[model samples]
Target: MSADAQTAGSRRSSETGFAARTGGGYSGPMPDITIVYEHPAWFLPLFTGLEARGISFDAVHADGLVFDPADTRPPAPVVFNRIAMSSFLRAPEHPIFFAQALMAQWQAVGARVVNGADVLAIDANKARQLALIAGLGLAIPATRVVHRAADLVAAAATLRFPVVVKANIGGSGAGIVRYDSADELAAAVADGNAPDSIDRVLMVQEYVPVRSGAITRIETLGGKYLYAIDVDGGGGFDLCPADVCLTAPGKAAVSVVQAHPAPELIAAAERIAVAAGMDVGGVEVMIDDRDGTPRFYDVNALSNFVADPVTVIGFDPHDRLIDWLADRIVESKA
Candidate 1:
């Protein structure tokens, strides 16, 4: 069969199956919401949940999306941003910057964008997020930032040995490397070992020892805390809840347990989300084993909520997420 024919058949089957999830009674106008996303598989459950609730949405791939600034109408009344930070790991021609412009245009014409461009700008740049978090009087890891690979060695000198050199635009721990000593970092830099991020910026940061051998990832919805997970870092940098990143080559499988962090941590996570303009996202923090201080590190706008929500978090977060999106859709139309 022709590929197009096969795709059409598969789409029909998918629609039929999605209808079953919500009991097959939705016959409303399509495009109540537009999901701006890149990854193909991560949002399948989200789509199913939206279908279950009869909330019609259009999914647009960020990689090849095109729009004219003069266009006043959005594909839907509400636009949900699912464009990821780790997109660069999948392709060099990733749409990190393209998404920024696209969402800004969507907002300009008054689309009720969930996790809009301003939040995405913070999400895209690690250096900017650290500064933003610090501006709130929160504790961040001791680190140095540099734009040129040549400056990496000098930056590492300020921090103790066993530091990670991270890319400013890294996603899912893409451009992170550890150097145990000054000599090792210098040799890497001399031999051109400095990591190449989408943008040329790099961060040389002191690796904080993880307390209890795990880091905390707290998820938020509508700028409020929804759930938290303790992902065992296990001496690796990538702590994405997705199996794809956790089981990547050279990375061992990590344990994920539902966590009940202190009220202060939950409050802090909510505060960061509100300040960062994150409508639906997650914040990651590592408790410094040496000082017992919780150091906020990563602000992720793209939250593909834990692998199996029911088994992991006792309830499916996607249900609540779709409910919120449905409310936003109603508000947007009004």
Candidate 2:
């Protein structure tokens, strides 16, 4: 790792798992856990894992902005994390920044935060994450991060028409649009860049034609590969039921095959997670039909698997992920 990366890693590591000491070193303690989640249903696996392990954790809604460390509610020696804050869920408006501040303050007071602020900030920026992924020698589609429609149009021309225009902060197919003709691409970019719209810049890329079947979702827990899910999707951009998607590769120009990606792709995910400080995170990749290279498109630091684990990976990821987190907690203490 470069000196800058190493320095950033060290700082992030300390922030995520260490407790400050009066004598200037660090101390360890039992991990009092606080879960930040909005949907109880989606977090069933986490809750199940915690319960199965006999660990008691306080659950906090992600929408809250005020947190008092002094309250008898949650004690120290805790891991404060809300895995649900990923783009899978829409970020609450107005208080989002303040909510993050409160969480950081709680951590400052004593709690160890898994997937801490540094990690979250880095993972949230799609362009930065993609650049890092590409830097790690992963194959990524030709991409252009642009603030204006003209730049996007130019990039499209360079990338050769029918590019994918996506919001820089988008996820789970949100804010994703495909434009076949130059006019269509230009119109989409104009809408995205309009003042009344989000006004957020976009990341445009040459849409890789993926084989139909499934897209691979690889999760890394503490720099270790956990599991991959083949996300079978509709032949087109829309989402279809997993069963339907897995039946056969659709005839769409770009089909979705959500399966265990190539070994190279898994390695790419590992590198990304380690660099992004995601002890536990997921990376999404699509097999490019043009050259048959698995090109990375998304990195999610906070992720939960709701798909059928037994059919997808031949085992339950909940058990594996929780076990890894449990062991990492002990290892961190050590």
Candidate 3:
């Protein structure tokens, strides 16, 4: 480990978001964990972390991934899910649903799936996330849900102007577009310019001017608060904070920094995680610039921690995550 990552080992307790230590490697016939994922680049850091700890893991790329019902034995004792909802953006034939089935198959036979199928169902749908958050008596953006782009115009009538039409199954900011006027939205629907989700569900939401031009993303693990990062996109909607995204050609830069959330904010995030069945994920709440109301809009099952951990956030969250994974390996064997 470099000095930056090594610095993380010294800081214990709350700053690291986990209490366990990286109990080290696994030497078993089957690997300790199997990560089911679709994206090619996102899990590089995680793979590196797992390997650094001398842990055993298997990476199953979900694209064109298949399995049979006859198979009873699991490849690993613990399965970690890494499938992304925005997978459809990279390829038309995405594995978002296939991943759910695969993990369900694993879980049925007693494999401990981190961020399993139940959690993926919530991660894959925005409408479901909003309802789940609202059911907890939490605030969310004023929005309308519909199954077709044509209905978006009608839905717009119920919401304020300058609203955004978001695909219910979206990620990395795909399938989201903002319209300033009702006519603009109507024209978009008329010209077939409005966005459609993989699941064909759409949400016309109040374009809450992001307070302070940024939105805060709170990460949780094991239904506990891990850490939060405020992501600022400088007026861009594709505000994904993963470092690899920053290097994409022609993409505007985003600012990512650690945020020490209040007790209420942390509690609310934790509640949403538990409700969503998210073993490891993030909950996003943007303070409505209009009235300073914190509108909880998104709950993500995949948390690619912010870039440059040591300098930006004082420690590498990945270290603690590895610690948790190591513990899981120990648990599965016991």
Candidate 4:
């Protein structure tokens, strides 16, 4: 998509999914809520819960590229921010800057962001996330977030064959690649990582061997652990449902879930969440079959439980998530 086309799509999507109202417009003493999201599929349950509570809310169409709420004033209450702007699903730089800008716009008019932009910034950066987890004394694999090819080679030498390289951003496993050999890693890096084809630095880590063929994704809201979603990344590079993925497992792939994680893993995840400053987020940890210990991996700010039924752990994660978010939103107000 051309830059103009991309920007236009983002704006249309942001606007279509949300409804916005200004001062003297919304009625009732309830919080005047504005949900900023681009995908309608994600908003349904969230809006449903808000409406169930009889909360007065609006939708504001804003994309990461051209998200400027110049005409609207920030209404009282909070902004449920769920905005993304990267055209390339696999490789999204901190396009969340747009979400930050929107929150800043709301703050100018006297309102609070649900999780706040600062929380998003800190959690979104993979390198930063690792540091936070490490600071919390959690066990993490010997990982490397490198920009240049030479550095990647160095990191590779430190690991066994088959290193995992994931795009620094995006959800549903957009630009996640696994190279079983050093040669494979070199070729993937040369091919230009994602749609942007920008020689962006890729995160290379020692692929934790897993016998179960699934990764454990645990969601936490306002520092409270909710539920765990087992994401079967189909064991390939393209796991993001938004894209065409052949790498993920077909229906034949055996996937299952348990209500609880190993006690140690859960405790570790809780610590990671707190240290990372994630008000509402998800932490992905891979259980190493070799050591039978969980390794902290990805930390997502706008963590998704929405696209559940079809992916990972088969359950209506969105409903549980909506309930959790609504509770937190109300709790914060209280």
Each model's TM-score, in the order given?
Answer: 0.90, 0.75, 0.90, 0.74
Q: What are the clashing pairs of model 4?
A: 14-61, 15-61, 18-59, 19-58, 19-59, 20-59, 172-240, 222-279, 234-248, 234-249
Off by over 4 Å in 2: 1-31, 68-75, 83-103, 189-199, 236-260, 331-334
Give residue 28's error in model 1 in angstroms: 12
Q: What's the C-alpha lDDT at position 276 in model 4?
A: 68
Which candidate should be chosen as best, given lDDT against the real structure?
3
Query: In candidate 1, which residue pairs get closer than 3 Å at backbone N, Cα or C atoms, i.e. clash?
Result: none
Per-residue alpha-carbon lDDT of candidate 2 for residues 1-334, written as tens digits (9 for 90 to 100): 0111111112311212321111111113323465655443456567667767876554444442244444332233455455443224344352333435555665576556677766766655778888888888888889988776568777777786667787665544556777788788777557754221143667778877776545677878878788776665544553322332234254233333336566777777888888887767788787877777788877777666535667646777778777765665565456
Q: Which 10-residue window in model 2 sums to the lowest lDDT?
A: 1-10
Tell me the TM-score of model 2.
Answer: 0.75
Check candidate 3 and list the clashing pairs.
none
The whole-model lDDT of each prediction reads: 0.80, 0.59, 0.81, 0.59
Model 4: how far residue 49 lies from native, Å: 2.1
Tens-digit lDDT string for candidate 1 (64-92)? 35666776756568888888888877777
Clashes of each: 0, 12, 0, 10
Model 3 lDDT on a 0 to 1 scale: 0.81
Cα RMSD to native, each candidate? 5.2, 9.9, 8.6, 6.2
